[model samples]
Target: MKNKQEIPAVIVADAKVFDYLKEKVGERKTRTEAYSDLLDKSLAGFISPFLRKQDYDLQPCQCHVTISDLATEWHWHRATVRSFLETLEAFGQLKRTRLAKSIVITMPVQSGQSSATFVIQRQPDFAIQLQEVLSDWIVGKTTSADVGNLCGQVVHQAMTGMTGYESRHCPDSHIDTASAHAGKQEEEIRKTALGCIAHAALQRVLWKSRFDDSSPLIEFFRHDLDEEWVSFIEASKELAELILDTEACETTFDTDDDKERLKSLRKPFLSLLARTQEPAD
Candidate 1:
């Protein structure tokens, strides 16, 4: 038997087969394990080293073609192509449709093979179109601003469009009024904006919290700002009191504590602005 390293090296050199293997087995595993699994499944044996003429016998000429035609054109096995088609459909890129057969194939003698025709439909590439539309929107509105402002604009556009759709097509008459749509849209926008602001605020705090001799709470804040900020502030307060207890001199404002306090205060400032802003403007 060939050495384990030699087998995987041979398989990995073929770009097409290597990519397929990598997709099946993630990047974290050893190459030997991936090759062993492929060999065990008989996939390695079935893979053709060179294209065969029969592979293109029933290929389609159009850009929009059936799964069977794609399989033939790409020289992929029928079952593998079927699996790929199913995955694409799940991702909303393809649609499948059925057609009634106008003619049937009859075998001369008792044969095991049976044949049927299926019609395949391809969805309009909405995912790519949506990405392009969003890119254009952002490009037109691009400006130098803080992260919070950028995130706010993106969220506003997405929520407004989604709310417009909800208003037009909502089936429940009781919940379909203009006021209800506006209220729900505002609530959603507020939640999303607040979440973004919180993230930005926490990021600023984390960046400042890092020093030559940082506390564990400060380190934790850097790693997990959302969950650790409250605890960090509480611990900072406790530390402030400890300093106060030890010092007998007159109270003098500490710059570090003042900065930490200001960092904690930015969230409420953004929240107030968000609450006061009108949706129409």
Candidate 2:
């Protein structure tokens, strides 16, 4: 078996010259270009508009999308869309939040902290998080958009020393009705930066005890975070620390009861968890 430290790192290429060359060469997309394009679309949420009903599960063009919608938009087979997403997800280059009918693609853009990798692992999906607030639209359907910094670069690097920031160029968002909206973007991230940092502390505590059989904290990492799960995590901090924390949880009546308590916590969120179909390892 390989040492845990032997894990390989994933590269996040800047969206620049490489794609320009690809476009000049041909219209057909390689898997590399497809992932690039998908990322680009999500980043370009300024124009994507919130055309659907006000379901808390949906984010505005501020970078939320359905798989069927994206496949049609890209003119690719749905299988093709799923394949690219699954591949990217496994590499940790992108994140996919699977909903009842469509998958919410996060992480085409990551910038200042409001959130981790987009807000927690090197997973940078906060691009939309900023836009949602900047544009004042119902953003990223994250159940706990309040926990915007749950998985952020500040949180990730502080927790694991990984460079979780994804610095892509922002689209033409003119809140001042001008060119770039950099000022406002930075402003809002500051507001949420503290929350992101606090969550990082929580993440660090969770990571230290991930292997403890009696602890279920690792469930956050094992499963893709949905809106419901996020809210559940934030809803009761002291309760979570007592029940989910490794040291705290181990002080149970017994292992069986410990598991039962863990199950109780999971039951509320399993609706989305059970329905989720992440790309296989």
Which number leads on lDDT?
2
Where in model 1 is the C-alpha error above 4 Å?
1-148, 171-178, 215-281
Worst 10 residues of 1 by lDDT: 114-123
Summarize candidate 2's per-residue lDDT along 123-206 as a digit string, tens digits. 333332333222221222333444444334333433232311222332235223211233333443454444434433443344
Question: Candidate 1 on 173-246: residue-level lDDT in tens?
Answer: 64546456556656644553454344334333433433323334444456545567676576445444543353
* Whole-model lDDT per candidate: 0.36, 0.44
Q: Report lDDT (Cα) of residue 190, candidate 1.
A: 56
C-alpha lDDT of residue 244 in model 1: 38
For candidate 2, the TM-score is 0.34
